[model samples]
Target: MTARTLHVDPSNAEQARSWDGEEGSYWAAHADDFDRALRAYQRPFLDAAALHRGERVLDIGCGSGLTSRAAARLTVGGPVLGVDLSGPMLRVARREAEREGLDSVRYEQVDAQTYPFPEASFDIAVSRMGVMFFADPVTAFRNIARALRPGGRVALLVWQGLERNEWFRSFATALAAGRDLPVPPPDEPGPFAMSDPGVVRDTLTAAGFDTPELTGLERPMTFGRDAERAYSFVSGMLAWMADDLDETGRARALANLRVDIEAHATPEGVRYASAVWVVTATRP
Candidate 1:
């Protein structure tokens, strides 16, 4: 969808720009790689949802529709709606759903934080590493809760602290190239926004959901089959890290990233430890 027709909260404007622009384009292009990287979390996250047949599903921030498609399959005969701010990723999601012949799945380009969803219409809401970037999470979640029926479930997979996520820590450190990068606040609108269990619990409670249950889950995230391929994938995803560096520093940073990624290479693939919280709650 074009910007003219896109609806988003004022607080989420910056995020909308990034997710709908180059960042979104890159993710859409490498959708398979991303899906594979996070494959280990799929079964567990979905399992937490405990979906039943004929249960309407709302997939928030459903990039590329991996989880949404899976939800559709699990809730056969039930309608599934996947919403996101990125038109490019939504396009990929739509195409994949069509290719899978999932007539029950539909996609929309809209911000989950402020989208006017049909009230009390959904049986469950799920997000895979997708709910943490909300500028106002409580408000975002409140919106989600309103869209759900009483007793409707909400399940989310969110990254743990950066220190516990080896993939991010190692990559960011290597990319820093000895330059100290400023850290965003723990509760900022980013990947680690919901990392703290206490914050997550509080947010959900304030948003009109039952106290959230945070379950710790650990897994190995695969970047690519080999170091070179992993480097290409990672560098593409985080090249902005080195954007302010000089020529020599940028080269050095890239070399450091390659070395670090190579250290994680295994016979099967380049993998690194990742910790996440599988948060579950019920709408009151």
Candidate 2:
């Protein structure tokens, strides 16, 4: 497929992605890694989204189509569309769909921030750690609302805070290697962007949804069989650092994180607890 620049929510969306031509390929290559990570710790979030079967559902930022596949299994009469910006991820999803013979689930490569989905179409929209990448969440939620049936609902599972997520804190700390790397601002355009309850309510309301109910979303993040496994797991981010790191710097960074992982490791394996906000709102 040719690379094309397209508007997501509108000419001026708050949350948009260019993908840099790698979104698809990167996720496609690591589909199993992504799936395993999600399955071990994200069952609660998926369970909450798969509610009310026979109602059309949209899986936004549906990387590798895990939630999309789950959505299809949950709905017998209604169909589900999995939208993502990565072509490679969609390819993996297609193969998985074929393997499972999932006829009701369909996947598409498109920007979720501004895609022109029909108004009042979906019964529910579910996103698992996907909705936060939008540069402008207010616009993204509004666009999401455009695709929902009246009284439809939107549910999301997003990271709560950096301090609360040990895996990420350890990852960042180890990657820093004595140089003070600034933690992402709380209001930045990522998972922590939606951590605030006031902001969550404001964004949902601005996007045409009623006041949202925020449920505490927490789970154990089992990284690997051991600390070594945990170190290897985070190498995904290291691989995608988008910077030229000399061999020494890279090795040191990895070593530092490995030690941290070892410190946090348990007898059974590398388990880190993370927290997220399970936000739900109705489209009024």
Candidate 3:
């Protein structure tokens, strides 16, 4: 295999590795499943973006190009470029776009935090559960601000906190049963780094974006069609957390996770309460 070209921040080296390695590959393989799981947030995210015809769009961290394709449908006269750190996910995105005949959608493997996007190249920038992984969020948003035309808008969906999101809270506790999971440092690059509204506001303001309008919303995150399916899916997604465990420990974690999942099972499907911050801001 030829080595891939990387246009990422040195600080994001660890993330690039995880996303480009096993994590990215797993997501690529389960692209459709993951999309279905996150389907609830799509409409809310797009509604906030308010995309229009002929409007250029930038989809930051556009994994598997699902959101990118949705944006492309609105802006047929303009292009939708989805940039991500994972080459595997980008490939899956490209394949799906071609299969769907979405000619206006494209995916690029680039770090949105530091990518040299052309000035005033986009009318809107959006991310669905994508903007929170930045090692240097201020620089990332600053770069994004520079990419947009004056008055261009940005809308994103980020998780609120561990306590608020039942999906992570339940699974994490179950997965760490009988084991000690160290707490991550505050402001560390992870899913919940942007959870605090005050930090988000400060970061955006410093990044040259107007004060962001943050709306908190709660919705169900679909796990699977049933408890059995949900257990398998959830286990696979969180399997990395048990990498350090022995075989017995891994099995115990899965056992605990199954019980936790069973409690949330519904006739419609396995649903978990998820909380998010739907933030919108304008480039000024």
Candidate 4:
């Protein structure tokens, strides 16, 4: 596999913008699965955020507006703004909001890590597996904290270690032949970027938040009506992860993914069991 850049720096916006500009069509092709996976992983974090009626909310990296709309539905009278860097994703979000006649939900395409939002503008801020790609997490969390009123709740969901998470770890191990891959640097952005509870606490406290807490949960990442649909969904995921693989390696990665799907299929569908961190903190 060749070394390629990733969307680790939330500040750069270029990589994610590139991933979206270039990889968005690929992601869009699997929009349904993406939305489903997000929804399944989001329940605990949303409950942690405890959105109340008439309280404005901010959803970071609100791809396709699924979580934003869900938050709006939970809020009843509250307005929710979904922000993302992908134009196509934001467009989808906008279209979906309009189609649902959801006036209270809006989507904006912006560099979420550095965007200059009004101070203390939201009663709550929530993200479903979206807060970990910041190149400079300190700035990102501080900015997000500044956007929330003091004592306003901030809750986000993040994947745990690759080992604890089977779907991603399985794919990585299969494609890489169980070779030990270096985890993201303590401060570098990537999946599992916020996995460590101590780091999460320290980061949130440094960002002007208090008493950051992390709760763990497990969920089934179900896909498709059957194995075919399941395989289709996981193939796209393989593409995202195997972008650097050579032809032979890529081919093998895909084959391994198929094996994984077949092995994990349930009576209703194929579901990858996943572990997550539902982290919540109050802006102090």
Q: Best-fitting candidate, measured by lDDT?
A: 1
> TM-score for model 2?
0.89
Q: For each candidate, what is the lDDT?
A: 0.93, 0.75, 0.88, 0.76
> Each model's RMSD to truth, in Å?
0.9, 2.6, 1.4, 4.0
For each predicted model, how many residue pairs clash, with residues at least 3 apart or on different chains? 0, 10, 0, 2
Worst 10 residues of 3 by lDDT: 1-10
lDDT per residue as tens, model 4, 1-284: 00032323435655475546756656666678787765576666777888888899999878777889888889995989998766667777888888988899987766667888899999988888778877777788899988998878888888877767777766666666444655556467777888888888888888889878888888877776677888887776656567677888778877887787788788967877788888888876
Q: Which lDDT tens digits does candidate 2 get at residues 73-168?
A: 878647889987766677878889889888888888777777789888899999887877777788888999999988899879877878788777
TM-scores of all candidate predictions against the true structure: 0.98, 0.89, 0.96, 0.89
Residue 203 local lDDT, model 4: 83
Worst 10 residues of 1 by lDDT: 1-10
Task: Evaluate residue 235 in candidate 2 and report its C-alpha lDDT on the 0 to 100 scale.
Answer: 70
> Between prediction 1 and prediction 4, which has the larger TM-score?
1
Any idea what lDDT model 4 has? 0.76
Query: Whose TM-score is greatest here?
Result: 1
Error of 2 at 284 (Å): 1.2
